[model samples]
Target: MSESIEMTAKAPVRSAPAPRRTTPAPRRRSTRRGPLHPATWAPTTVLVLILGLIWSAIAAEHPYILPELSEVGLALVDRPEVFLTNAWTTLSIALAGVACGAGTAFVLALVMSEVPVVRRALMPLAVVLNVTPVVALAPGLVLAFGFGMTPKVVVTAIITFFPVLINVTTGLRAVPPSVLHVFETLHASRTEVLWRARILYGLPYTFAALRVVMPLSIVGAVVAEFVAAGSTGGLGTMIRNAASTARLESVYAAIACLAAMGVLMLALVTAVERRVLFWHESQRRAST
Candidate 1:
């Protein structure tokens, strides 16, 4: 009986299966990172300093051609009202032109992106317009529109439209096939596809173009005003008058005003980009 009990216990112990060993799971990485420091601004700071130094050197060497920064400052202070009024006029015209041009470009780009035939027809026209020199057309526009702000605005629009059109069209077509397949399976309508997929997908590129287009539009407006030669109320006209009268410092002041306007426009576009394309990689990195 003792041998039988012992044998039974041994048999049961040997027959039991071993416990399965479990491997531990790997650690997951955290996606969080810290904000950008002041060092992030280093490149822009260096560029500004370099530009200032070069400008100072040029002003010191050629007092007649390039007025001293201090002289330009004095000119700005001496006639603040004139500067403000002229600058306001220039801003008004430039902003108007940009708004109109951007709107038109957006509609045309949407159409072209969806319809391959339209894209084939319009893309060549866009390229030709882009390659056409603004200087050559500005004079003709002024002659046709009779030296008014109308002509200047049209000239600015013509100069700025191509970039917006090209960039937005490129972006609209850039939606991935995988994403489009999802939409297709869901049976989304054409308007839904455009609004939910294409336009939203293209938002970053549109804003990117805006960043370039806004300042260039301002420059175009000012240049057109200079060519038109009848207006005394904008920065371009002020610069022309100052140059003709040999007031180099005043001309420099007008140039400074133009630069300030360009900077403001660029800043505004950047702000809008952050707000509108906040989901984009560029903005995401910037925010982080």
Candidate 2:
């Protein structure tokens, strides 16, 4: 009986299943896509290509109409003195005008922020000034300021002011609720809140508005020169000379110079923006 019981146990043990082997689970990979930002060179690249094609076509037919890029380049190189002097004159006026306009706008925007009643009073007045038409008003400005930089500067300031005012006001109003709440919790005074919070927050917008106004101010200065004509040797005067003499090429060259000036001024403003507001979203976008 003992031997039979032992045999039964051994037989059950022998029939038991073999040890099961377990396999490790497969690892999963993350399939997230990276940032899909556009490149800065894309637009400039396309513009250059289009300009080159147009230039080439012009060069092929009516070569005079399509002055050789090389010719224009040579003209730039050969008589840089004329271009540089005229550019300097125009730029000085433009900078002066920008200063006046920006200062006035800053003060006005601050005042408006503090006194909404003043804003309501001044807004319609500003609109009347803005839509009064530059060509018609420019002659009157020249008549008042007497055919010198004074008139040009005044015209430029007039044309340039509204943009700065609008932008600065908008910026002053952009103070975030969270920031305001923080100020309140700290028991900050109204002046402190404005100087520390509102102005700081509005800086980017102020710069953006200046970027727009700077170019327009240039146009304004040039227009004033047109009205004050025959006494000045500005780019505007150069245009008149070319027009009177029927030198279309020279006129085109002057126009090109004006374009270059606008580009340079705008570029400088953009650089300032990048430096001053490196943390701002706009700067990040421009960089990308």
Candidate 3:
């Protein structure tokens, strides 16, 4: 017994390791992308069904005021070329105008972001311009620029400019105070901060504005067409002409094209935003 005790005492002793202060692995949040995926077109499918039901009810009740979607479909099928031609004209001018306006707005927004004096002077002016009815402004633009694409382009620019400028400016100012202070401490140049931080952070905001402004550009173009007596072009002209002749089906058909155009524009912007902002946290959350 003595020998056994001595041997045991001589043996190495082991105590249980203090419970490891392990951080539990972070809970993996499950993310699924089946029906809810933005690419799934699920919402659009449901909307189309709802629209179909509404159309059927309207067609059965008052075909005169709101003609059957079938009637509009027939009109579109019968003279697709006419509709396409007018649509192209309107789209062309709207595209050009939006491009010019967006470029100008970007430059102006950047300047406003950098210069308090400019921001103070111009923001209210921009708001005033934005609030002025395009209906009223279109006529004068037409008179000034003559009844050409120029007036319509100007009108579209007027419509698209403010939203982009507002969003970009708001985004520029959204930088964290700490981040700005750090940059100042580091003596970063204005141009450096503008390009690397402000512009990068402002992308999401700018894109949101793009989505809102696109349809507005269409409305502006149409309004300009209404006032552009000598335009002799565009779906708006066709619409006004058809309405005057009491061709209600044609009017509906033309309006459908406008709706389609708006949908396409929104889709284009959404796709671009998704691609460009894939690394952003909000965008990543949406994707997952």
Candidate RMSDs in order: 4.3, 7.4, 3.7
Each prediction's whole-model lDDT (CA): 0.86, 0.82, 0.87
- Residue pairs clashing in model 2 are none
Per-candidate TM-scores read 0.84, 0.79, 0.87
Ranking by lDDT: 3, 1, 2
lDDT of 2 by residue, 1-288 (tens): 999998988884447687899898887654433345235466767899999889878877876455666666776778779877887787778788888978898899999999999999998998898898777876777677776687777777888999999999999999999999999999999999999999989999899898999888789778777776344677887778877976555666777898988988898897888899998887776554
lDDT of 3 by residue, 1-288 (tens): 999999999999898889879788998776756667775777889999999999879878987778877888999999999999999998888888888888789899999998999999999999999899877877777778887799889988988998899898998888888888888999999998988789888998999999998877788788778877697988899999999988989998999999899889998998899999998887888866
Candidates 2 and 3, the one with greater lDDT: 3
Per-residue lDDT of candidate 1, residues 1-288 (tens digit) = 999999988884456777899998987664544336455677778999999889899989988878888888999999999999999998888888887888899999999988999999989988998898877887777678886688888878887899899899988998999989999999998889899999888988888899999999879888878776577678888888888999999988988888988999899888877787777888777754
Where is the poorest 10-residue window by lDDT in model 2?
31-40
**RMSD, model 3, all Cα superposed?**
3.7
Model 1, residue 216: distance off in Å is 0.9
lDDT winner:
3
